[model samples]
Target: MASVTSAESGRLGTLPLGYYSCSEPGDAGGQAWIDLPDKHFTIGNGSTYHTDAGSGTYLLTGKRVIFTRGPMKGVRFERSGKVTLRWIDEDGKPGRVRCVRQASSV
Candidate 1:
């Protein structure tokens, strides 16, 4: 399950794996945009891209999340115990993120 906090944006979980990328007109979960050519970028947790397209998936342990910024955030609760995320990519493309677990915090 996903731990949720108030609108405070405090550190909530652990991001074991970080991902980033360099992409063209479209950006995905692990991609970025660069003026230069043939360059790669690393996607680390807590890293924000200038483009709304830039999003990070930090591994969450047993803590909850509090969204302190943004106009809209779509967080969901399901029977499978999962969460799907949508963030702007570095290239400005809408990216989809999914998180799954057996159980959430009590």
Candidate 2:
């Protein structure tokens, strides 16, 4: 197995580091939020991503992203556009959840 460094991982995929607004069926007002900061990943409702403690690590490969650890572990998403990601259901089809980049961060 080959090992990937932090610098290498950042260059492996196109997901940008920032806040994202996610919408899905059944969600309140059909909205949620996620934050991608370097190697850390956080998901929360409204704008609570900054305070949420359920954050975990993520892995990006090609056009797919997988929540590798934490509360969101096992969740997978596929890039649908320049700044959009769609959830991948267990059946491997795009689910109702769609996330778009809301803001960029350093």
Candidate 3:
């Protein structure tokens, strides 16, 4: 496989290079101060992403983002907005977890 530099990631990858937070809704009963469990990720160039668990390569095909390697291999998501991604289950159903782009990159 070819290596991709951080600067080249922007031109090679479909998604914007930056930090992202993936979260699932918490059962806080609508409490504002309650925090939802979130996972941090770095969307890097060359269709790559990194999390606390591991790093992975992804493929952006139209609106779908599919993980091709590493810990998240085989996981898939669909682009919900410019800065958001919604998980897609095996049955093609949208999942509760959502990943939102942050203001910075690694």
**TM-score on alpha carbons, each prediction:** 0.22, 0.61, 0.75
Q: How far is candidate 3 from the true structure (C-alpha RMSD, Å)?
A: 7.7
- Go through the candidates in order and give the C-alpha RMSD of each one to the true structure: 12.2, 8.6, 7.7
Candidate 3 residues lying further than 4 Å off, grouped into runs, are 1-13, 31-38
At residue 31, what lDDT does model 1 achieve? 41
lDDT of 2 by residue, 5-80 (tens): 4533544544666766666645456435433343233333321233144666666776777777766677788877
Candidate 2 deviant stretches above 4 angstroms: 1-11, 25-51
In candidate 2, the residue pairs with backbone N, CA or C atoms under 3 Å apart (3 or more residues apart, or in different chains) clash, namely none
The alpha-carbon lDDT assigned to residue 66 of candidate 1 equals 19
**Scored by Cα lDDT, where does model 3 land?**
0.76
Candidate 3 lDDT, tens digit per residue, 39-81?
5678887888887788989987667787899878888888878
The candidate with the higher TM-score, 1 or 3, is: 3
- Residue 43 local lDDT, model 3: 88
lDDT (Cα, 0-100) at 94 in candidate 1: 46
What ranking of all candidate models by TM-score puts the best one first?
Answer: 3, 2, 1
TM-score winner among the candidates? 3
Instruction: Choose 2 or 3, whichever is better by lDDT.
Output: 3
